[model samples]
Target: VGAALAAAPGADEAYGGFVYIMWGEKANCLSQVAHRNLETLLSAAPNARYRFFLYGPAQAAGYRIADGLSKVQFQRYAKRGYDVHMRLVNARWGPYAPATGVRDAWADQTNVGEDWPGEDRPGEAWWYAHRSRFPYEDKKHSKLKSVQPHPRDAFFNAVVHMYLTGGVHTDLTVAFSGLEKLTTGAEAQYAMYGDGCERRDAAYDDIITEFDGWDVSLPMALYFPDAGHPALKCVLDKYDQAVQNLSGLDAMERYCLTPQAPNGFPFYHEEEPHEGDYEAPPPAGMAQLRPGHGACARYLLETCKAQTELQDPAAPALKAMTVEWMGCDAGFHWDQWRFPYAASKPFRELAAPEGFDAAGVTGVWTGAALHGKRWEEPPEEHFISKEIYRAHPATRWDHPALKAGLLARQWQRENAIADVEDADRVFAEDPDFPKCAAALPACTSFFHDFSELKDMQYYREDAPKSPRNAAAARCSPTLIIPGAEKGASTFLYSLLAEHPQMISPLKGAGFKETGAYLAGFDRPGQLWDKTSHFPLIRENEPFLTGDATVINMVDKGAAKRVVRDNPNPKVIFSLRNPTDRLWSAYRFTFNVYYKTHLPDLSYANIVNDSVDGFGQCMQRQLSGAAAAAAGAAGEDAGDAEIE
Candidate 1:
């Protein structure tokens, strides 16, 4: 805490300050410590702006306390000089994903006092009995007290229920921790991620659900499902999209074929295409073509009908077509475009006089822009690359055209090479990431699921587990993560275990803490070897391995034995305020020991008297043999605080 204060202010221009916290034993306790740490730091440090994102009851505690105390007291925190720009309460606890019928009692946030003033218990209680009938539940859960249409009206109601309403709205900076929930496999892929019409538009939706988290470093990662920054906007365009129409293409990319694979062509048209007119016997050109993708696109182009011709564009005939999102083709170049079949023009007059069977059979050499009064001439130069013309068996090419064709082909090869470089970079940096990216409930499409599977395979092939790690376990003494009681050893353990580079007791040994030093294993090496308990190697890199047992610092003999066995071993120690640690230990121990092991001890007596010899060697106090003699003679030599 002192160190961070001593250091000059850090910088994140977007969101000013970080609200750091550690979840503890009791949800209440965890929030308590986290709140204290956050409040202490913000009060001391000076910063340009602060964006406070709080979670659970601790956040509401302020609002609850303020409402319980007085409105003026609550306003005081916001009145401070610093810019507390945003206060978003992500008020979720218990399972991140729950069944449709289920409801969390704590999550049912309401302030009945606001409606039935001074009634305190009775009037509000009466309102609560019939509140479900009125629209009061709507304002109770909505930010700014407004209703937004939602899909699955029941789910919309569920979202409304998660709102935090206990606190009085502070300043403009205050925001509701809106509900946006979607686990990986819980719902249909498109339902939770499509354009605005899908109601799964993450860009517009609040509350995102991710179980294992993702490798955000991947290019265009956020644009995909389950991996994106909170600030990222999803669902660029809104329409009742026919998602199932492209299922086959989606499957191909997801499973055996990768999205980036050259063989699996993307749906969107490229910047340029080879041109060949259907004049004479037949024009021939070797160029890849990706025409209208879905049924709607094909129908519109085939019918030569304008956007107005379709009374309802989402008709079955048009819904299955593939097309671009939206664009402007004012320059006569095909570059200006729009998609979803509904948006693009499909008139025969816009293309050719003999539209359907024209050059290349149903090709549109020209088209009208959405706003333009008249049709524009085909921008032949833009669409027809010299490379396409050259590819034809019979061609009278100009020197300039031939040179340009060759240059374009060379550029393509260079781009392909650059793509390889990027793939390699991703592999080298996060090669083994896929092994753990297995989302709970599992992703549906092979393209999305197999994306990580392929990466995992590549990592395993490139970096096999080391045999030496098995050997290291036989002789190497375990690294220790000792604790100052209540210093978040469990929280730290879980975080470290998530890292590929670190191995904890759960990974190496069977249990989280072996307790071998205190237990006095006959042959610790043999037992460890027999169990094959070792930190497994990953990616040809050694892991930082250790076990956590908070008692080690006070266990003098345990430390001595570890030094004797392994001359050099790392030790991690975490500390907290003595009084705070005692309080936390009280909470933990009182629950476990009060009725069972320490029936004789009161909470206060335990906290005050037990602090002295809790982690000390009582024998050392009397300086060895003389004390040993006193102990042997039938005297009460051990410290009363010790036992």
Candidate 2:
């Protein structure tokens, strides 16, 4: 029993206490800025132990960063005679004790299809877990059940981690500037940052600003003196009940759940009676809205709000002390900087900053914790650099002028703006020029219609309709290589280009294929005529042009389109094994799209990792395709065996 107890976390005093940070599903790898901030935090807080709960399929690089930090953190504190432990923990392990067999096993289940109209089919434990992590409701049905897009998983995890280990709980973006002060018992039992939950009414505390709403503090940076706090337990109990209530509903019922308004807005479901058989007014009393009954209702009313006014015995011993300081000020948070308007001076001053950092008055926001849907493409690195942060396009004096200047500079980099004429040409050509000009001072005067001027300055010879080519007759490609991607299409194309008769477009003009037809822009635009691609070809030369668009093989209509465009066209397709092609495509996509973003993730790890979402997707596609084929063959798809 002693050995077992000793093995458990929070059992030893060597590592002063735990500081838990939830790095949500989106962040597969730590950015350069996050790494620097974390290193600084560790250096500042030598005594406190840190554990980052990383969610999702994090790349190998992220683990390397964690592993590297863990190895070196001990050395930093050894000289000072303090125990240091910094490591990463996969959030999949969950906070539940082994005694309670409530593990998330939904991923392991096969053929768990979409929620259709059906009988009551209670969700698995894993479904509940998934819903908690991603809590946005379907909102199709009239009955509203869910809260707005709040990070329920992170919130619940914060409470659980603090309740169990008893220390500071923070979002990954939160820096530990004042960790030493807070951890040394200088602060109250419950300390929180109040940037998010600012109360405007006099009934609450008058800290006047545009933000007037609920008095609920965010879990972005929460600190508890000790483990087993009744308030924390109350939160966990309420949250668990909410999760259970969701699991009771079948897939259809879950799908029909309407999302509630933002935290401060009037929750219509609570204000008005829900339609149909459930017309009872929501219970106002805390006890009346206990675990099994209206856990969600309770959550909206009491649990999510600041518990200061709660007269219940479990209410905190003292009102949680609001941590208001320079670095701790929520206004300088990284999230606000994502949008141009939000980061503007007007919004920054009015919105009332809702982010906190421990780095003091540096005012440089770094790190992203709330994942949402940015996994497909990582967040833009506009403000990551100190230079870019300082030159923030939105927050500048005379926002339009600054944006114009930045836009002009960007344009100048791409196309030379040597003089007024060059500037006019570049500005006219720039895609962003129209939008930027619309917002600029005297926008109409800044841009001019140069069409007439260009037309007047004509040459002696009549201008050709398209770019110069071997002959006017040689407009479209005589050869079309409909592709099998990852089937050595480029290699084949290069070999074919070596022949004197077989000419290919220059690298600037569709090196592999113009992709005009592939992109569905089969019109007389920039990428339409073959003459535009073979500009340097000698007039009257007998040369055959070809387009090797690898994706063309996948599109059914590409052949018809190619044949219609060219009179005497020769088509070729280099087919590869489907499995090998898919694997190669996966690797290529990972390398081209995700490798730089998630450096540590190995393709092998991605293939081996839990959650075969891709496989499930493929299964659905194949099933649908089989059903379609059966239908085309005039057979009943219901009885047809999909092999």
Question: For model 1, what is the C-alpha lDDT against the true structure?
Answer: 0.27
The reply for model 2, stretches above 4 Å from the true place, is 1-15, 24-33, 57-92, 97-150, 186-219, 243-322, 325-338, 346-643
Q: Give the per-residue lDDT of model 1 (tens digit) for 1-643.
A: 1221122222112322222111111111111112222232333233423332222222222122110111111111233233433221222221121222212322232221224334222212222322232221212432211111111111111212111111111111101111011111121111011112111122311111210011100000000122211111001000101121223322211111111122111111111111232111111110001111111111212232223235444422211111112122211122122221333353222332222221131011222222111111123342211211111111111233222222233233333211122333433576453332321111111011112222232111111111222233233334567676588776776676554334443222223454645534323223322222222221211233456666766776777655554456667777777778777887776876755667556677775566566535555654564556557663454333334
- TM-scores, all candidates, are 0.24, 0.34
Q: Which ranges of candidate 1 are over 4 A from the true structure?
A: 1-479, 507-511, 522-526, 529-531, 538-540, 560-567, 592-600, 608-643
**Among these predicted structures, which one has the highest TM-score?**
2
- What's the distance in Å from true for residue 607, model 1? 3.6
Global lDDT of each model? 0.27, 0.39
Candidate 1 local Cα displacement, residue 286, angstroms: 66
